[model samples]
Target: MKKLITALSVFAFLGFAGAAHAAEASGRIAMADPGTSTLTLEDGTTFEVVEGVPLDGLAPGTEVTVSYEEQDGKNVATSIAPAQ
Candidate 1:
């Protein structure tokens, strides 16, 4: 019973740790490349846009907020929207 509890606790902690890596960034678009499905901010932070996240109307100098997760040393964007 104790070993099972410990294993469950470890799995829960690992799951939360992965969730903790999700983050958001607000900045002006420095570059938006549909061919590569990537967006780069003015600060040089680049994010890889996941499939199904529309990039329409996004362009250089447009302010946007990016929701992303750090995966395998790259920022994988889950969503992007214009900044209010």
Candidate 2:
């Protein structure tokens, strides 16, 4: 019983560690380039939209929240949504 509890605790800790590496930003779109599949925030932070993460219908001046992860020294957006 104790061993099982310890294993579960370790798995939970690992999950949290993965989540810690992710980040979120909410702001208006400063620029969006469909040709490049990239976008920039109003604050000048740039993000590369990951494969399967939809950016359709979004345009400059649209407010959105992006969930991203840092990879290759760049922010890669995992998901994006209109800001509520």
Per-residue lDDT of candidate 1, residues 1-84 (tens digit): 999999999999999787747799999999988889999999999999999998877979999999999888899999999899
Q: Where is model 2 poorest over a 10-residue stretch in terms of lDDT?
A: 14-23
lDDT of 2: 0.89
Tell me each candidate's TM-score: 0.80, 0.72
Every candidate's CA RMSD: 2.6, 4.2
- Which residue pairs clash within candidate 2? none
Model 2 earns a TM-score of: 0.72
**Which runs in model 2 stand beyond 4 Å of their true positions?**
1-20
Total clashes in model 2, counting residue pairs 3 or more apart in sequence or in different chains: 0
Give candidate 1 regions above 4 Å deviation.
Answer: 1-20
The digit string of per-residue lDDT tens for model 2 on 1-84 reads 999999999999999778638899999998877778898999999999977876678888999999989886889998889999
Task: Provide the global lDDT of candidate 1 against the true structure.
Answer: 0.92
